[model samples]
Target: MQTTKKSSGWHLRDVIMLTLIAIFFGFIFWIWAFAYDAVAATPLKPFANDITLGAWIMAGPLAGYLLRKAGASFLGEFLAAFAEMIIGSQWGVSTLLSGLIQGIGGELGFALTGYKKWNSFSLVLSTLTSTIVTFGYDLYASGYTSYSLGMLITLFIIRFLSIGFFGGVLVAAITKLIDKSGILNR
Candidate 1:
């Protein structure tokens, strides 16, 4: 009988898989951020920062599902941010800070479950956590708090869509895909 190690909660293969996922997120964020800046003044303005929240919804819960661990989401997000910084993100040093906070927000969902289990429901919860945290980040970092009530409402709606669509649906789909691969089988 092969026994899992106690000290190392992960294997080399697990690290490799999570690292690739993290890198994928870094690319996704970079492209999405640039697209936001380009089209913010246009008719697609609502789609601007909204995608930022969506990205977390997709990446965070998916990481948790893939690794089935407590810290995997956070580790993946942090790796993604590190990759972004190394790859020359336009957000500069602040990207690292945002990644840290955002990762923690996403990780909260998995943490709430005590890292014992995850499902589509848990993915939704994780996405919601990411949305709330990122929204707060926007209020302070992006100065959204200075905006009017209507704008705030609009922001909230966008965040809801981001989390619901990306975290709930997208992550669920991806998790199913990974599970079907049997790569995570213990």
Candidate 2:
């Protein structure tokens, strides 16, 4: 039986792959954050709250699967937040904090699975984990408990969709694409 050191499993290629993916997603996250904030500030905000929770949920699993490491989700999200800051996020340091918590939530899902597996089921599980953690954070951070149960539930459902579809399905698809490219052939 060959035992592998946890961090030792990460090779130069792994770091590079994770770094590139983090930068890419971080850039996207910055753009998304800016657009979301802009739209949220508009009078049409109520009608424009279209992007669901599932989308956010998807990022963690997507990152975890692609990097196939316990820290990948965390690193990826942090990178995204860093990217947001570099791109001039109005939230400034707050975005970094949110990303840290959110990434930890997502990372926990895969970590619970022992980081020895990567699959659609794991991704879905990751989404669910992130949703619970992030939504709790929102409830406290944003004072969302003041909202009605129906509205809260609605938000939860949408968040699940966002995380599941975007983080789970989308991450899976991206990882598959990378695999096809033979970039991370391990």
Which candidate leads the pack in lDDT? 1
Q: Any idea what lDDT model 2 has?
A: 0.71
Model 2 stretches astray by more than 4 angstroms: 1-13, 38-59
Candidate 1: residue 184 Cα off by (Å):
2.1
Give all TM-scores, in the order shown. Answer: 0.86, 0.82
- Count of steric clashes across candidates, in order: 0, 15
What Cα-based lDDT does every candidate model obtain? 0.76, 0.71
Shift in Å, residue 19, candidate 1? 1.6
